[model samples]
Target: MKKLLLLLVAVIGLSSCNKDSQEPRPVVPEGEGQPISVSFTGEVEDDSPRALEGTVNGSPAGKLLSFRGKGDVYGWVYVVDKDGEFAKGYKKLKVSEDGRSLSYEGTVPTTRSGGGTIDNATAKVSIYIGLDASGVFTNKGFKSIENVGHASGSSLGDDFAILKSENNALTYVSRSISGKYHEYKASNGKLSFSMAGSLILIRFRNEFQSPSHKVLWRKISGVLIKVADGAPLTRDPAIIDQMRVMNLHIDKIKIAVKDGNTQLTGTNEPSSGFIDNSTRYPNGYFFNLAKTVSIPTNTNRGVNSPFDNRESVIAFYTPISKRVDGRAGELAAFSFRLQNEAHYKEERFEDGLFSMASHRSVTFRSELEEGRVHRALLNITYQHVEGGGKN
Candidate 1:
């Protein structure tokens, strides 16, 4: 009869909808933790400026090198709720021996009791460069971040505060630079994630060999990479697709300097070559003058370059994107200090924005001069099939 036909059609439609939705796979045995294995093996999009491989001032301008990407790559899995937000708990993945893969084995918590079936539930996976055991995530790749505890599956919004440690413990926490964002799925026990974003490495130094202080410790207070106009910088993989779809452009970035409170904006001036010069940046950006290192006489590396002292390199990681400048490239920002200025502890900084066409070494003076990949990235470089070949 007509009534029977209508009921059958409704049942079929409901089944079809369930099939299309991101529902959890059939549950495994109660105690058998769902095995979630994540592997990272893919080429990140390269938009750094090109460099000619030749001699520069009688020295090799370009040297072949690899990329030993800073920090340990991490994988985080989050459970999603029906409202399209992070729910329940998340698992911190373990890195493989080769550093290309991350894995986690545990029951996907779907109930308050901590042990329940994931059937009909949703899962999201996110992969990122660097590791932070601290519950919160920051932008200073391989550097210390705000000491805070954010439980798994917590909703992170656009404006998150990074707190400074009150103690004098110089504990260093890794900042996650480029992240693969979030990938959602109704799982079947196994999951895989790939990373294809760009990396931003920011290094620091004292341009002068001598300053007026005993320990002219120049430090980068913080680093921020904004991808969209209204996206939350979160580790939850479930909402990555939403943020990515919102916008993949670099809206703004802020890198707080040590104490000068300087803001450097990029300019087309020919004199803007690298050294902290004022004339090059007519945009009214503050440049730390006093072009000499201000450290203890005996502790000074004495050499003008930071590379001479292995401790001078302060690396960072940031997501890659089609730059807002229309060239569709990656952007980077830097924070610096000259006298152990505690800008980070005070949180007194104004974010700045800038772009780099060429993705070269940030602070390795010899490597920058020779155009070689810094030793930090020696094991992770790849030759992008663009203009010529670039890392």
Candidate 2:
């Protein structure tokens, strides 16, 4: 009986020792080194157009969120260690069918770039959205990404153009992960992104008065806008009319991403002269209207208002400089082609003086802001003389 009790006690002690010596199953604390979940929670500007409400390829209209073609939206996630070296390579984020979420296919690194385990408290995760495959490879090696606009010879790509249909206009966004590891890990590693740029809405209006019954406002053939300085130019001595009008468009915009922050540079391309280099406007960059806008003739009403027709143009991701002077600076100059119908009682008025195409320009001191609509009223008024008015 004594030997049996001793043997039983020894067996129990051995079993208890084994259970205590186990590695505790190495608890992973949930979401440790797991793939991240990315979702588009929408943009900061509420009133502005939503970025995801556009179609790509044959995808459903206003349902696809991509630029140029399908699967063009590439993502670069930087998992940096304490030494600022990349811990992982580029990961392609697959976009969900709903176009609302994106996810990485690979698992997050458990170790640092060098060798040791990643310091979740000190390490950082930076994410970049809206880059193409080419763009990603071109900028992958660098610690940061820099995009030079038209002025710097680097193209902003086809996706930057706002007028390229509702579905085609796209911009880039970036964000750096904040807070502690457990906080993000517990939430399943979801992130929200906002637009890194602004929108400029240019509302054009014809507020002109007719001097005589014979001359009537017909339509505006085209509109041109340029950045300028000094005081606004006069109607009679139109600066744009004196100089040859060159077809200029904003081809690119500047953007930079560093240390997890994104910014749009205010550098713009210089305007070229039509005749010679001497006529070149250094600070002037012109954008021509894609189409002509016609104004209806209201014979009874003397003034033509934009509220009647509501014709406007939208400039996407255009950068505006901060006002140096407390007052308004001559930020933009507008010129438009004015057409009119003139009739005299005697003849068909084929040779009428006012029948020729009229070109008028107006410069105003106004400030342009981002994510807001700026209304520019081009007042087309005619002052008739007793003999013959100037064209």
Candidate 3:
């Protein structure tokens, strides 16, 4: 009886082992395209001394504008492998309700001919926002980022021009990914997109304290921006060579003001601000404004109040050069034109043009960085005349 029980236990153990071995194992399909999930996180770097407060129009200052509500926010995605670029398509990113994150879904090529899986395959993906499909890609389906904002015949313009509106300024961010085929399946990494350019904010402050020194602040008719020589505002190699010794001009800037504040409240202007690349101004562009911007006068309220109650500010969006060889970018020189040239002369000021570089007392040399707010304060203070009497 003991021998018989031992034989039966041995048979049961063998049977259990067989059953376990026969069970099916889970299998992942191979030799086919794989689904990929990519997430984008937008970031804006405010390099200004003081953080910007409130909003310009409805868009927050020093922040990426909301992309959800705008139907025009879209970009192209390109995927490349060892075999070169295989897939390129337009993708309209879905922005989160809060507008902080964006998401995209697509398939990554992973297989070869004859149902063979590509070994040691790598994938590279690139996404560019804030540009139209036709403007960003050529008819051959290749990316033509070199001539983004270039004039029809002019050789100069921003390679990746940022679109701006009274409501919001459109910014762009790009990201790339690369690894083995299977690694992409586990890759849900965050792609950070920063503001591809810089925001220039010029604040007008009236610092005249003495009643006798008070001068009438004239309406600003236009402003001129001359970027430093060798500033690489565009990506074209040929254009960069030509720009080495040339200054990029942004002239004929008409300002729009409401009440006493320099707020963008115009509706007749181009939503994306027109870029005039006339050859009359080489390596320069201009945008129109609805009305003239007037500067506020200093309030003579004893020692407590020195500035006016209203804020006079003008904003400009420009592309900044990337740092090369550890060198920082240069700040653009600014010159403002007054509506009444005689008013500036009457106050003993030099001409109607207020050049930021001409003032020696006010030293402002902020290194320019992409996606940062470069704030410049222009104080319309009165110069004390030797013979002029002051209370």
Candidate 4:
């Protein structure tokens, strides 16, 4: 009886200690993009759009949490700190409209982080990019970039654009604008108007170490693209209105020299027209020539078109000054192939222009010196952006 009484007293003491302890809650691990569990308050699988709710793993001991969305509704659901560049990838979640459940072939945010081509049923999703007390969305700075916002979609589209920003060229496009644009700011980066609706923030990525694109091209000549000489010249003062001429302004071009140095150059004059050498624009004026064919400046030397297309381009551009070749006279006349990828398109204005995110990525190869003027001879290949193969 004495031993039983002692055991009961010990049990009561243990119960009292247990009653004083606080309950522990499950949490997301730090650094890793582990899932943060939260209750989905409503019918998430219904046909109508629905917001998926969840708590970001607890941060800072007593920190408040915040959230937002990145990428399209169909892309990975990103987990990040409230303010910073977006994370590498996101969580792969199953979204459904009719309950068929559409998802990537493989769980992304693991296998791939960007350039996702969606061609299935429309995926409507809304993710809350939550922030913690420290004013960050994730403990890591992945989602902590400035100007945090949400990204959503009403359809599963093949083309997507990434937002771009820079010093002067309007780097900030509203993510709320339902489009994406890739900001090519490299020295030899190419810019395409196909991304018209989307923004292309161009800068001398080397600008941090080098001069601005403006300062770099200050001394260099712009492009001189030539289409069919037979194109009827227009008397209009606007160079763009002459789209009937089957030509466009050589905006920017990216080229890699046979010696293996990549150079990015652009137009002192934004667009060119039927005006040839006769029309005085600047030291870098593009004139429509009779037979001579050359690609525009800075384009991927290997991926432009032949000079024979009804719409061919020619430009006289000099790369930014380099230690090897300072701002000096033209280099030795050598030939390189220009496979034209971009096309001569005539678009109508006044209406909201078509929104497109142009990949327009290209490759190049060195060609032999042809004659008096040796240059790259690019075999214009049709812009085949879908098949994952060249045309």
Tell me model 4's lDDT, rounded to 2 decimals.
0.19
lDDT of 3 by residue, 107-224 (tens): 4333334434322235445555544444231111001111111221111112223322111111212223553323232132455454434444444444432222212232345432
lDDT of 1 by residue, 1-391 (tens): 0100000000000001111221222332323333322222322213111211221112122111111121222222334323332222233334344333334443333332333322233233332222122222332222211111111111111111111100011111222233312222323333323222222222222222222121111124543433323222221101000000111212123222222121112123222112322354222122232222222222322122222322222222222223223333332223333333221111111222221111122221111111111222211011212222111
Q: Rank the candidates by lDDT, best first.
A: 3, 2, 1, 4
Which candidate number would show the highest lDDT if scored against the true structure?
Answer: 3
C-alpha lDDT of all candidate models, in order: 0.23, 0.28, 0.31, 0.19
Can you tell me which runs of candidate 1 are displaced by over 4 Å? 1-75, 80-87, 92-100, 111-135, 140-199, 203-311, 319-335, 340-391
Candidate 3 vs. true structure, TM-score: 0.45
- TM-score for all predictions? 0.27, 0.42, 0.45, 0.16
Worst 10 residues of 2 by lDDT: 5-14
Every model's Cα RMSD, please? 25.8, 23.3, 25.1, 29.8
lDDT of 4 by residue, 326-354 (tens): 23442212112222211221111122221
* Candidate 3 clash figure, as a count: 0
lDDT of 3 at 147: 15
